[model samples]
Target: MTVIENIVGRVTVLRGGRYSVEVDVITSSGFGRFAAPVDENPDLYIAEAHRAVSEVDEIIGPELIGFDATEQELIDSYLWEIDGTEDFSHIGANTALAVSVATAKAAASEKNLPLYTYLGGTFTTELPVPILEFASDSEFDYYVMVRDLMEITDVVDAVNGVLSNLKEATVEGYSEATEKASSELGLDVALGLAQKAPMDMEKLLTLVEDNNVAYLKPMGDEELFLELIAGTHGVFIDGEYLFRQKDILDRRYYNALSIKPINLGTLTDLYNLINDAKSERIVPILAEARFESSDEALAHMAVGFRCPAVVLRKDSIAKLNELIRIAEDLGERGRVITFEG
Candidate 1:
């Protein structure tokens, strides 16, 4: 048995000088580390990171000392019980997730198994398709949905060509630009939008219709959410607004949902949500928080969960590079997932 010996947390400074908590879980036979980045205001991120580390060293670490690292469900339950909060507001969700994931990694190390193999079993080989978001020099953002990354010899060059066309095209001409780039680069590309604020429904619908946007992350009231689903034709509506609302799946409000580990609080919770989404025939896309660490555990989780797609930004190269390595490791068994949405 791999018994938990100690848990240590340190403040880690990420790119752009952002702060995150790096957790080290030490067990009787192995060790694991994970960095938890919180989605907080830039001004308060440093303080939040420090507080999480302090909570781990003084509170969570001491309580979990004698627990078995392999008993993931029990450890996650204890995390909720100790926090005594419905939303993990007391201890913070990022802290709980860090501890939960690190425990899994520790147990995997004890057995000399890869993290994905430990969590997903021996036959998990399919890699999720990368949903790469590129922002042009003109500040226009679009997504390149690669059908098969292994097929592309130079992904950077292909994406550069896509961005160049996007820079010259107007918002109304985005669909044409994407289509042109797709034909020239021989890649399946699509337009994507993330709603940061409320917009007129007519305007939103017009943009979606005109640009042929295939992916949307909308944030608004239930009416707006339902309207987007109803108005668009074959658009992949990501359920960012519907996080933790599994009941909404029954209504089929969104075809896909973004799974962020920090929002779920623990690995058990994240796993349950992914299973719930799949059981409902909804696609689960592993997504990072607005702010993130360089940790590549998320890439492993995407493969482990068998998620079809991963929504990642340009700066998330660490996760992308990790996916490439996982693909190479899987060899002939590795294939990009077909995006259903």
Candidate 2:
């Protein structure tokens, strides 16, 4: 009975004056709205937001008006048919993807299930490790945040660790904290970093390898991706990488991939990406979408069940407690919260 009644799409200017589509899917029970993540590449942008909205208004809306939003495959199939491209070209991947996510949300709300509970299901209790991120230096009880930790390390580590002990501890200290916390919990925790931007990938990898750090979310283009892959670093493939060269996904050259739903365009796509990551022995680290609202963050935690870890950026600081609550509600624990002020 909870079918889609109608879908309305709009164009909004996002941060930095980029445009994206925001789509609202109204179902018999409730409505869900999603704003597309900003596209970084202009040359291959998914159709302008206005044009995407126009297609949604004139064509996609009519076909989906009475469709069952919960029938994800059916609805997404229609969306793909409308676009007729793997990346959503004809009808705008951003718009189509937003509708896809909105539809999933609406359906979940209709069932009165928290989005994470729905995506992760009722009986699944275990959750991924939370990789706490801090934009500044801060201190908190490791016992309060650290819990059971797990890791998969190869033979490469010659040294170890994280921040200059400012936003985070020195990379060596970070690893020690995780090690200490793991000892307390009797769990095996590995340190991860989102700090490859300013560092030399080769040198940084050596640093992390020597120090015993586990992974690096060094986001970059094809060349960087290939470099990370060749170095056998646990690469964190993200939205920008996905948008630019998803073909890289065809080859499982890395050991980990961190993705956000917004970059993926739909709940289904996000789900599939996790599956892909898993199949390739790549640990999926669900990262926050670009400036996503709180609900989207919840959705990430919901699917966090499917990943080994989830990375929360600085924007998630205020909502971290709420996110932890949701994870606990699902019987999932192990939260490492790092933050800055």
Candidate 3:
């Protein structure tokens, strides 16, 4: 048996070409803290589990042995089959969660950041504590995890379920399927924004009354505000409001603001417009840029570069940083600096 199993704790290869993996602490101290029964021979249990998995592997591994592990859905099919077998739900769930988490960790490692950083939010502080609520599930394409606390009771289970479901959904183009479910359930869904700085709990509740807002974001400082706007997609700026658009929003790409100067499109006019927007604390998202010496001209061109002139509400620093990051990432030729109050 040319077993190529690597050591990552419970990752193991047993005879009959079976593989079993577990993500659990095998230490006595961990068992002591739990009220559950502790196995004196955890190794033996692990071994038996692997043997069982190997037997099942003989039946399924051939179909998948040389397949991609990074393609989790493909890997999950066999696991799902194992789950359907007699007395395998707990093991299957545990195995799947561990494997899924490992895959996520690996991806994050490739990006050289923590998993939450990969999700969003800067690694400037500790991870925000997520709020947990236990209600009958409804139809929201996305659920925003709110609160700044490290942990809240009651929500742990739901969060895991949502995360797991989200991963699977992402792998499968879950939007189409969810849309079908929403139609069948007759759920009236809408998308909107929530202001959540210093945790605006009441405002969030109020915004949700309409249920039209899909994304509720806290308006941070200048930098953060800009970042948030950069993050939003599918809505283009129209005058002062974000008008809905049919195109999918790409969080990665930059959108430009359009400038109008009495039908004269000159470099001087462009610079002035871009500068004016910046002077007013509006970080203009520019498209179609070329090098220009004057900061004034560069700034003006930035403003009138695109639709709706998406600007952050002043004093949102985190948002300002985010916006600056977006511009910088898109190779805008200006260095971001804070204005003194």
Candidate number of the best TM-score: 1
Cα lDDT tens digits, model 1, 155-244, are 454566567776455555666667777788777666777666667878877888888578887766667778888888777888767654
List where candidate 1 sits over 4 angstroms from the true fold: 136-141, 147-158, 244-247
Q: Can you tell me which runs of candidate 2 are displaced by over 4 Å? A: 12-18, 39-47, 132-191, 194-202, 218-252, 297-305, 318-321, 331-341
**Best candidate, lDDT:** 1
lDDT of 3 by residue, 60-107 (tens): 334434434334444455555655654234344324433333433343
CA lDDT of each candidate?
0.79, 0.58, 0.31
Ordering by TM-score: 1, 2, 3
Better of 2 and 3 by TM-score: 2
At residue 12, candidate 3 shows an lDDT of 48
Over all chains combined, what TM-score does candidate 3 have? 0.24
lDDT of 3: 0.31
Instruction: State the TM-score for model 1.
Output: 0.91
TM-score of each: 0.91, 0.69, 0.24
lDDT of 2 by residue, 211-311 (tens): 54555555555566566656644334333344335555544345566676666666677778788766765666676544444445443444445665666
Clashes of each: 0, 13, 50
Error of 1 at 132 (Å): 1.7
User: How many pairs in model 1 have backbone atoms within 3 A of each other, for residues 3 or more apart or on separate chains, i.e. clashes?
Assistant: 0
RMSD of 3: 22.5
